[model samples]
Target chain A: MILVMGPVDELVTAFFLKHLTDTKREYLFVDERHLGGDVRLELDLPQGPSGKGRLRGAVHFPTWRVGLEELTGIYSRLGTGNVEQRKTPEARAEQAHAAALLDLFPGPVANRATAMLSNGSKPCQYAAILAAGLRVPDTLVGGTWERWEPFARALDGDPVIKSVSDERSLVKQVSWEATRASARPGQALAPHQFQQRIHGTNIRAHVVGARHVLACRAETQALDYRHPDMTGHTVSLRATELPEPVAEACRRLSRALGVDLAGIDLIEPPGGSSRPEDWVCLEVNTCPGFMWFEQNAGLPIARVLADFLGTPLGS
Target chain B: MSNQSTDAGLISSQDLPKLAEAGHVAAPTVGNSAAELREAVQAALAEQWSLMGIIDTGKKASDLGKKAADALTDKGKEIEDKAIHREKDARDEAHRKMNDDKAKKHGREAGAHGATTNAFARALSELRG
Candidate 1:
């Protein structure tokens, strides 16, 4: 049975569960919303590589019990809680227990927490992206004002700044005035990521498991399609095709990053030969919110995801 | 590109702290019995009816909602439809603003005096691993 873990009210998780139910797939859901009250989990993990070291546990719902051994795959969308929520004993326990199972499960997990660590550093992900034979835009992370001034001046266009890590920040072009203001003596500045803005069409490719690639093109004039409202530009999405090599690179990148599922953002440069090298990879999202793409582009992402999670590992 | 600067999103900097607080507020859990909660959850699944039909389940969740509402013997179908539409609207609104909300929250926190330095340092260490 597949184990889907997340809040039932959440769009992605809700749709996933709906897909599984509609398809009559055998599955169990650990609702995160009422974890402290309605759901309970227990795990007993021992050290060493002996047979007893295998994961042994069960998740208990109000009227049903699901053993770890019964699960063949797991798809977790659990978000980390803040300091105060972390202090809540029961909720904290369930979150930690669920997280541990996701981490230690021998079967297929959409993403193991360890694999998702690369998302913490965009530069770190860039190395893997490059290894997968994709180009990454020239990027500078966390430099002094005196150091960045020369780099920004040399850019062909205004440099856009974003959060260096997975921390969300809309792509914004730093005005020369803002750049110049940092030069004043004793003025404090946060270490932000500045990248040479690449002009191109936005393509989001969702790579599932090893080979399933569902891609869509975002038609937008906004600097960041995700928040087009911020730039007063509306956005639309449509299913698109990717060249084989680029799609393969996406698969390789997903494999390299150790994510069973990934949402890779790519910029297809205008007037370029359709080749993997011509595409600029922005970043690989480990836990992508794919429902938006599915809703807009009419892509069957949830169905594909359900099939992936329902299939037994190594089958 | 225009020279005029703008905030990262519709969320102003002043609202950042409040958003952070609101994000952490937990939803209240139901105090019903197991059977009642299960029945309620199954009924709540009816809300999926108004969603885009990605697959044809032969009349689907809406049919189920209508059946349940019919069993209630009130003007329940209309009320159910309205609730579903309201939920769908809320979800659409949430979907559009989700990224901006996260961006503004992170931007506010990371803009603090030394948070970026510490975060970057931690990132570098993670990269080294």
Candidate 2:
């Protein structure tokens, strides 16, 4: 049996569940909203060798229960809803315990909780991206106007500003003068991500099971294709193929990050060759809402994701 | 040179209403002012378009709008319902015209989805931290 954890109504979770059901897979739906209420969890992991420990647990629903040992794999979207904002102590403990199980469960968790931590720090991911042989745009995490002046000067133009961490922010191109004019005297600006803006087509590659690579290109004049309205430009998405070397690099990056499934963003520079080094690595999303891609590009992301989750590790 | 490609639909600011029609994104309440309405629309757009990954593990669900699921705050929805009722009862011509203009500007019909709004995208952005 497979375990799907999240709000049943969330788009991505719902999409995955639909596919899993249509495929006739035996899976347990653990609704995060119902946790501590309609759903309960009991886990027992006695002390043992680091890798030899066995996680024994059972998830109890109103009318049924399933043992952790019976779970062949796990696909979790628990963070997709307000479950994390539990007010009651009981609710908090329940969520924490479930998260622990997701972290320690020795199976193909779409992404282990630990692997997902790489997304918390963009710079850290950049190091991994570079080591994976992908080009990382010049990025500055935090600095005052004086500190940033030289870095911005080295760029093609005013650098693009964005959120440093996983927090989502609009990617905006601002000139050095605009930044200095807005900065207060002698005070360090709040930590922000400023990176060299690469002129290219935006490509999102979904790497599944470190082998299946489905990619699409987003054609938009907007600095951030995600919010085309902000730039008054329409966005078109179409399925595309990644160059073999770049596709292989994405696979390596996913394996290195320990994310069984990853949404890897890249920028293919204008007039660039098919070489892996020509594509600029942006960031990897552990829990990608691939429904949008599937709907627009007609990529079989959901079906592939479902297939990946159904197969037990080392099968 | 075009890489291997397939036909995928387009998404843009103009496509906001289409998303509502397709039942993908929730239409927000028509705000009191044009600026507020635009904010609501952009927020809605951001809610639907921005590709945010898993929110912080322990943060509150204050940003549920990002997932584009659930109803807007109950209080806000109630207020929206009351405003619509008042407009209908009073037969306020100017109020109605203003709403129509706002709707046209945003490419969304005013009160399109009744009183309930989708999760507020601004709230979702704030909680993403």
Candidate 3:
């Protein structure tokens, strides 16, 4: 049996659940949205050395009492909050307890909460990627314009300025001339990331277990392809092969980050260079939105994820 | 009750490693072994050549051979001096271009600043009304 943890209405979750149903697999879709009909949790962590730990719990809904122990695999997409409509103290406590309990399940979880914490910091993620033998852009993180101005001037080409955190920030190319004019006193009070801009086409690889489903987007005039100009040259997505070393790097990086599934962003330089050292890994998205890539490239990412979950731990 | 079943509730550390390994996770090579091998071979050849020179140390250069060697050394020095002069000229040219680019950029920025200040003043006056 498999446990799918996340909002069931989410497209990725819904698609995977459909495949599981077609295969007649015994699975439970556990979301905070469907909590507390008669839901209760019981966990026993024995005290003595000889004592064995046991977790036996059930969520009693109107129609089913889903046993937690029967789960052999788990795919968790649980974001940061509880399913409760109102944010009460009791609801928060229950949500915390439920999240912790699920962490104890210990089967082949797609990603553990502890492992996913690295995504919270871009610097930490870059360090992990470097250690995994992947190349990362030279970065400068600073809070003051006095310090940032020199670094920006030293770069050969335009540098990319973005937020240091995972929060959505427009990745804009720094034009020293324009920025110098728009500069306001105390503007650099907040920390910002200054990365050496790389020139290349973007390649996003959805790595499901051991499989790498890669798609390449054509070069665009926009700094970020997500917000492309409609009248200008349109960006195109096509299935492509990753250089062997890059493919290996992606796999190693995913393992090092302790995420079984990941969406790895790689910058493939022009002239189609396959040398591993030439490619730059931008970032690894632990929970990437697959609907856009799936709709564009016609890749069966959901089916791949479902098959990976249904398979046994060592098989 | 000692429940030794593999289907027990939680995944153990031992179980997690097996899952990662079983997935055929790519283990990238830490260093270029082929390049290392080539370097090793080159060092060995260099040592052999040095040893061969030691064995032939008794060979002496003739007076004519010595004169030719000195002439070649003088020619090399002349070529080296010209190369150095050319390199210096190239460096100076590059430095000049960089300074020019910086000046042009600063001029553009100053112009933009003037425009921005004018726009801000206009907006402020409109808001006051």
Candidate 4:
């Protein structure tokens, strides 16, 4: 059985529920800790189509002392709390606590809380994906006043700066480059992640099995597609298989992070830099928007999930 | 003092030390009790929400709010894990079944898959084994 741990925002929860049913799967969602433990396992032990099914049981542990006899797999989807609602001190503490708990799971955890963090933050994710021999963009993460100023000054006004770790985490998500951006040397009030923005469409790689890479490109407003003002681009989902090395890297990254799967986001920078060595692996999403990506990418992710858990997906 | 209580004029952060000095504050509702403060803050926020929106989530409780606040303080990485588990269960399941079957059919391939994709392929191979 698999367990879901976050508050399960209404929209995200509804999407998963729909997919769970569509894929002929059932889940035990846990947001609060019960008397014994705070965990939820999506049990499917009932003897049904697979014949190998057993007497099912689902339980979540605030700790991982419990057994894993009927266990099959696990998923981590929790994220930092909403930002705008929180205050300064509360926000910092909350994010730090979230990071710690991310590091603190019961047993058989995926997505290392430590591995998930980086000095470069999201840029580090891209670097890791690249180092794993995957296709990634020619990205850059700079905070040095001298080093980044040169790059920023020369670039077309719209480069994307992903704040390392908890920078814009709480505020409106720092998804893309600012619409009205201004850059002055030393104007960086806080440390920031400045990557030479990719000018291609988004490719959301829903990496499950080793070679099982469901790659799909999403449309957005401008070059850095995730920008808030991106409404002109109409999303058209299609499944594009990643090359062997890139696919292999997707698998390797999941392994390195201790997660069996991830939603690896990438970009095909404008030029023919589409080669394996040229593509930029943006970030690895531990808890990606399954419904949104599926809708945009048109991958049979729900079905894939249902099959994984021995239930029916998109059922 | 909690944020809500402070907002309600029940007790101010400055008054907290005085209240403690007067031996009026409880263990779970004071300066060191960050959780209690958070609850009060949440309640205060909720009250604001009540005024801004319709205030439908029921009135916040001092005790419950404190508990939530305390949990919030201590809930570090668990938040991310919760997010993943909550959203990815369905997909993870389907992934398990297909990969597990792949394990039975293609051991070496599954091994490579696991090596490449972590336990995803490894678990599939385990099922096969």
Question: lDDT: which candidate is best?
Answer: 1
- Best candidate (score: TM-score): 1
Tens-digit lDDT track of model 3 for A1-315: 777655443334444554565555766555544333223344443333321124445544444455655666678765521122325554455555555554454455665544555555677789878876777888888657776778788888878987664443447787777766777765653467888998888888877764555555545566766434312235566667788877887888877766667888888887767676788887888766554566566667766776777666445
List the candidates ranked by DockQ, beginning with the highest.
Answer: 1, 2, 4, 3
lDDT of 3 at A300: 70
Task: Evaluate every candidate with DockQ and list the scores.
Answer: 0.05, 0.03, 0.01, 0.02
| Model 3 complex DockQ against the native | 0.01
TM-score of chain B of 3: 0.29
Q: Which portions of model 2 miss their true places by more than 4 Å?
A: A49-53, A82-84, B1-129
Off by over 4 Å in 3: A22-24, A36-42, A47-63, A80-85, A186-189, A210-219, A229-233, B1-129
Native contacts kept (model 1): 0.02
Report the Cα lDDT for residue A134, model 3: 73
lDDT of 2 by residue, B1-129 (tens): 001111122322332222212123343333443234334434433443332211221112422432333265676666655644653344334334433433342223112322211243222222221
Chain B TM-score against the true chain B, candidate 1: 0.29
Worst 10 residues of 4 chain B by lDDT: B19-28
Q: What is the TM-score of chain B alone in each candidate?
A: 0.29, 0.24, 0.29, 0.19
CAPRI tier of model 3: incorrect
lDDT of 2 by residue, A55-99 (tens): 677887556567777777888876653223345777767887887
**Which wins on DockQ, candidate 2 or candidate 4?**
2
Structure candidate 2, residue pairs in collision: none
Q: Candidates' TM-scores?
A: 0.72, 0.71, 0.63, 0.51
Ranking by TM-score: 1, 2, 3, 4
**Per-residue error at A111 for model 4, in Å?**
4.3
State candidate 1's DockQ: 0.05
Cα deviation of A279, candidate 2, in Å: 1.4
